[model samples]
Target: MKHQSSEYVVVIGGGFSGLATAGLLAASGHRVTLLEMQDSLGGRAGRLHRDGFSFDTGPSWYLMPEVIEHWFKLMGTSTTVELDLVDLEVGYRTWFQGHPDPLDMTTGPGAVAAFESVQTGAGVALEKYLAYAETSYGLALEHFLYDGFSSVRSLLNPRLPALLPRLAPLLSRSLDSFVAQRFSDPRLRQILGYPAVFLGSSPKHTPALYHLMSHLDLTQGVKYPLGGFAKLVDAMAELCTKAGVKIVTGATAEGIDTVQTGRHTRVDSVRWSDSRGETHRLDASVVVGAADLHHIESRLLPRKLRSSSDAAWKRRDPGPSAVLICLGIRGKLPKLLHHNLLFTQDWDENFGRIRRGEPLDTETSIYVCMPSATDPGVAPAGHENLFMLIPAPTLPEWGTGGADGNGSEQVEAVADAALAQLAAWAGIPDLAERIVVRQTFGPGDFVNNVNAWRGGALGLAHTLGQSAFFRPANRSAKVEGLHYAGSSVRPGVGVPMCLISAEITAKAVNGIKDLGPFSMDGQNRDAREPEGDVQEERVAK
Candidate 1:
């Protein structure tokens, strides 16, 4: 059942999407060579080491355990074997600006109790909301996420007609409005709406359909990989290597070489520069642009060959950027949990400033991750690992940052303000003095390092028009063998979405279209193989 033909595939960017794409394609009998611009892999899910502390500089919250487990299973392994995942007792701690006591959020009965404490009958309301969320989550996983909307006819599934009534309101309304309809308390609404930030959007702009995100954490509970996100990256890299994919680090893709065949055009090879500034080109029958889609479209591909042009991108929202603060503290912070969120009272105004391209707010929502609480290996015995994220506008005017706050004034100012805010809000007045090591990464770093569009921390915002079939297509309209896989493409951002993007791109390359999730029994078989070939396997399953 293995693929009979093996074509040379070149994957650009060694991020989660790129690494996952390479591994999947290689496993399907393609000779894959992945090029990463950075010295190391992981892209946005990056790790930083300072003093005796290790910080997950990028994504920390490990949501969607099922997706991760599915990915590991696809790679011919299990999550239990590849990762040491710990289910957090407390999902996260939310501290309001003026409130003295912090609210600890957890799944199931604990979550209900927390909500009930805030408002009478809120626990019942929460259960109702979660019921809808869980249903949407299941429906999306079955009918939407895995399927590539290659044709209009693909939308005509029998199940969709019955489900559309339930989904219509979710798609049309904003998440903020949706949550407000269910809960009167602002804290309850904020708790439900804050997940929109993970989608690189504001709750006011994000579709209510994203409420399904709550089901992942509020129902299933939050989990963390013991060694930070780097462990997940390392595991993916190892899988790619095992699948015979050759990974090249410090390789910056300069251009995509193409050749015309009659009326059609296809990618020929990828030309990249190594760390030593030496140029090299490797012929590729197929090319997957798993990096920043904007970077790939604007820089690598030729103007005429580009599927999404600069003009097209200008019309889209590039999403909010962030000022990332990584700290290595000398003492323990018992007040903080493994995950902490400091939310401003005014959610609308805070989001409005970023959406309107206004200046950074004096009072803004910020997320803090203390991974050391769960994993002792991340920091020294007496120290704690702290990572803070302050979401900001993707405006180039905001400037950049560097290690120890040596770079742009604006970037350092934001970091300083965030620290003061954290200290005051969390009741740690000497938090700044406790910092033994510090590093600040700004929007500009996203541009300089990952070639992120408008220095965006995440890719395109998941606005209604920028979602689902409306998102930039995975395969190029002009080029035959050109495909895209990553945050910017269909199925949207996050590590789980990126992994799904990889599978979609891989399946498309193998001539499968509009297919749902792969069956466990058919894991090793080519998806595009004739039905007769896998009939016996299907029967056995």
Candidate 2:
């Protein structure tokens, strides 16, 4: 962990990826400066306080514990000591449209029995599917997750031709078809299928390969940081500081300046605007775009320096945008758990409307996270902190009751409808009256606050073509000393994936080996360690 004075690395965006990237680079001996546009360090993971209610406005569920452990280990710290982790006994509860009782799922393996109770043979089906899912998860971790996609060749191998026969099933079918073929109960299907929306795609469109999420969902189990996602973000920042990474918040990187150094034009400095609107410049040998990749490219760099044209980005399918509502209720929500999924009867129809850029229909699916159920401190005593998310398409216009769709003002309308539906489904008739505080974020807000492209919550869809090496490359072939990370890059989406993305990007930018053959063949790590090391020669195909 020796510091190198010769090279300086400028990491853009102080989000999870930026923090991780800067920390790793600093450990590897590069002078690191992390610039964040917002006033805080955590980008989407930042907290919002309204009327004494605390909210993790973006990510709520902390699914992959191994990723977090591996992250701290890389930083030479203990995750357990730095952050408190708790297993959510009831991982989540589902209020399906027709089901008489809300389905309660636990964090441990006991959830199999619960699924079986819904449908006679569902428990067996779930076990069998998890077995297959585990193998796919191993393959994905081996081939995709750990490495930076520097080139198209990263996605190919000699064994790919052989695996084409085995890949037929996954490549041909959607996640909907994969689970629907195995499970008979509609409730079970919705329960399994609903996670695809978290990745910004519906099960009907998401690739079957993403079934690996099921392995994380039921088998690996859901856990959380005791306080909130803010605690986890704080832990990451603390680790970054200890690793000697300089964090610069309230400073926006406006443009990346490059100089021709032999065969390539290398990024040498960055021009940024500070909180007081004062402009500053920092020189660096390497530049990492930890912010919105498209925004960094189109907004910061000249058109000639950008790797992808505007049309090329439009060609890629941006994932779903969300209409979010954060609330503080006066009384407890007895009918709700820490996590609640309000599934609609017309699930497919809901997805269809969103895909068409239409607003959420009357009978729409809403994901409600009641943090107060898990921690009382998030809200006032005897009160509740509630965060609701509705998946809507990223339309051109966002406003209340516009011809195109509903705007930010329409949040109350939608929240009222969602409350009425929740109360009816959960037998809590007085759910609407308990609200003491409320705030809403629409597509326009995402555009303004986060520089989100078309207000997309997640970067890109994990469709078959959009995933793997088909995504934007980490290393820039057109520009030297430039890299990209976060949801938009390969091994896409999720908070945990961002950690891996930063590791791979740092490896690429810092001129490290990047575990090339090591990650695929699992030749570097010991056999006993089972977090992500894949021992077999199986990767692609």
Candidate 3:
């Protein structure tokens, strides 16, 4: 077979991690063939469009905007060209028990005050807890996350020795346990533990290191893209095309083929079924798997090497599969801000039922994203593109409340109920009547489109046992020329971490030097814009 020196690297799922891997590899002087099964590239960050209104699919919360921008600039474009990001003043509103007014946790001290309102010294306790979170977050970025840990020896580095003291605190304790120890009030505990679910796992199971979410949100701040996350994906897609990467949409990957002799193995190529149902094979020097870890392991790789029997592998990693309700409303919701979180009174019971695979509580928590409140471009004139999500488990256990094994129908009903609840919770006037166009994505929808294993919205649970070295490594242990990225792999979930994971994976594939994890702000400050930027010129179709 003829081979190209700048190998035709086939990137299997075109989510944030997959695209980032493809884009960086192409920019670094390698030819890349990106294969995405869906009609779109964003993966979990899916897009919905109707009557000139656009809505972001899954991940509505935009943190670390600079991570996307930095990669784009590296490939000759800035985020500004395709998406306008506005920093939120009130990051999120949490309605604690007994407090009539919800806690607007934009300011750090205000979050401290929420605890203070419950007890005299709770504010001081929170300050101390936040200080500890800050310390662990700094250590994690500097030592644990940035470097690729090829083996256990690599994790025992002397530089990371200082992190040893924190490892017990961060690794041994769950987010819920850590918060309960620090706060006497259950209300304060709920508010603090809420962000842990962003990992897609419940706070009781998620690691304490996830406390970084507080720093990432309340301190670093939350941002919203002008046209939602889809705009950001579109911007990156434009850059990839300009960089000469071959993006094949509507192409479903089948599996990989590898031949081995002694210690070395050659990945011959990848096979995929396109829209026409014709099987297409492309020879490649390298292959990167960007889809779900289980899909890549079971469907794509040879069966002998799969980890189906491993206890850790078989255990369900509960990521809250979101039921997104997108509405193209006839008019704007002036009372709603750019971002809002509507909390239910019995939040614990709600999560308990979800974890148990029962129906989500009638009064479940909801996240509302009103992009028109910030960018105005997402919705048509005098209209709004509203995205509301209720987090729930992907799988439905037997004999659960009204779920009846058909998760799609049950989840859709839950989405409708949640929307109705949201309108009442937030006091939105005539919200049900205002929606001119609407759609919903349930667990089955995520499974069919993204091929997310068991319809898991996020990858693995970010618990102490499943994070960092515990996560499936970027470099496959048994398979050569096969690598993993996306939510399941290292650096964990979210757009920033996904992009970072891709960068590190590409470096490992190319044998390039590791660049330590830098903050989104740090990257923008250090990296220079290319002259005559490609983003300035429209790509020749």
Candidate 4:
């Protein structure tokens, strides 16, 4: 049966990905309704406030500002309206326990010189490696990321024949192996491979394509909106509303209403519950499940329409879940940057424990976000907003190794130990004493907040076998009108990638061309553009 092109679209999840997809669809002159179970938006990257301090609970750092710019521009909105984007100077710091000096990464020549000083010829090796990363970046941006990935044929396109060779180099070997091949110095290797933790995978499992993150940060630069990461969310949500999209927060989708006729199953409506405990069923021509893909398929959809357990989404390639300790400090640490990393002595063993669902090392590596150093407004005067993340196992059986029996208590204990160790490593005295406010989200929190199966923080780990075309498809093979986006879906994790996931899903539903080249958002990905006409004013909060 033929249908109207301007059919009403309902997005089940209202995270960055869902919101972005709805925005893109609305911009295209389609009626888009976004349903968010939570009271507020931003999902994993949501915000929290206690006393006079404000905390960016999820998505502490904003990498690749250009990707964000391209998104806003696609919606015909200027970035200046929602955020005051600024480039961070001190890239980050890496401490190797007993080293005489801390590895502080500056913007350009200084960083190159620092690497050269650490290892005899690492600067040259880094140059070559970065060149390769740039090639991979261009290839990924132009061919793999921006397009709608449905079948293997999409990747093996005759129009983009050059992709095969580049794809090999990008996904050929492990990022750890690539780093080891390039840099002889262990410290240099650690610094380069450190960011892999954010991808929610061990260095050995993550593909070399992720090495492009180096170029994105060092060359392209790390940026932050004047507000927190939430500013981008606000901006995107505003675009969706201006494009005539309706956003309903605190609305939980309970079930799907479908009609089956012979071979086809058609989605007729959606059953949902709001924060007020009222239930409503709305008719929808097509449904985009922007939440976790696993949840949508396994839990949200009926059993008959679901696929059997696949290794990629099941036991194998499961990503590491994180336990984040977000703190609003009373004062700033003098040596920290907008972004910094405190490395543990044994990263291999650390990942090993996490892979097996064990407690992380007390001296575990921590990614610290100090936005207050760049933009003072994030915290109160003379204070800082910090997020300390320790990636650990999501297994329910993972006990606290004596720190309160259960994983939550264990997470807090380990986080406390991590902060103490961080203070010693960075030479910051009484670091824990200065904390005026603290909030934490462990693997347990991840499950409760987003219905992330098994409390997996980011979706599936970006292992070599589960990359690009290998990842789950945007459109569900089980359900005709149901689509998937966000971290779990292709292209991968992170705020930018989540946005790209939305774009890909939108294109799959509307049969429109995906948005143009965007800077990487979320994990590794291309998000959707706003659907209809871009609007300037803010939506009703």
The prediction achieving the highest lDDT against the true structure is 1
Q: How does model 3 fare in lDDT? A: 0.73
Across 218-294, the per-residue lDDT of candidate 1 in tens digits comes to 99999999999999999999999998788989988988889989998988878888888788887888999999998
What is the clash count for each candidate, in the order shown? 0, 3, 0, 27
Q: For all the candidates, what are their Cα RMSDs to the real structure?
A: 5.9, 7.8, 6.2, 5.7
Task: Count steric clashes of candidate 3.
Answer: 0
Worst 10 residues of 4 by lDDT: 519-528
lDDT of 3 by residue, 500-531 (tens): 88877866766654447422221222122243
Best by TM-score: 1
Error of 2 at 531 (Å): 37
Clashing pairs in 3: none
Clashing residue pairs, backbone N/CA/C < 3 A, model 2: 399-406, 399-407, 400-407
Q: Model 1's lDDT to the true fold?
A: 0.87
Worst 10 residues of 2 by lDDT: 517-526
Greater TM-score among 1 and 2 belongs to: 1
Query: Residue by residue across 1-541, what tens digits does model 4's lDDT show?
Result: 1222565678898888888888777666567788999999888877877666666777866776656666787677777766788777767777786774787787667678779989988887777877777777777777777665676657567856655676676677889998998888878888878667767687888998899878776667667787787777888888888877889999988877688878888776777887877788777778888887777777767877765464545555658887777777787688777777777778788888888877676677777877778777778888888877777788633322211223456667777787888788878878888877777777777777888867777777788776777777777776678787888868888887887777787666655443444322221111223444332222112
Question: For residues 115-229, could you state the per-residue lDDT of candidate 2 as single tens digits?
Answer: 8888887888888888888888877776668766565455466556776775678867999999899997778888889888878788998989888888887888888787899
lDDT of each: 0.87, 0.78, 0.73, 0.74
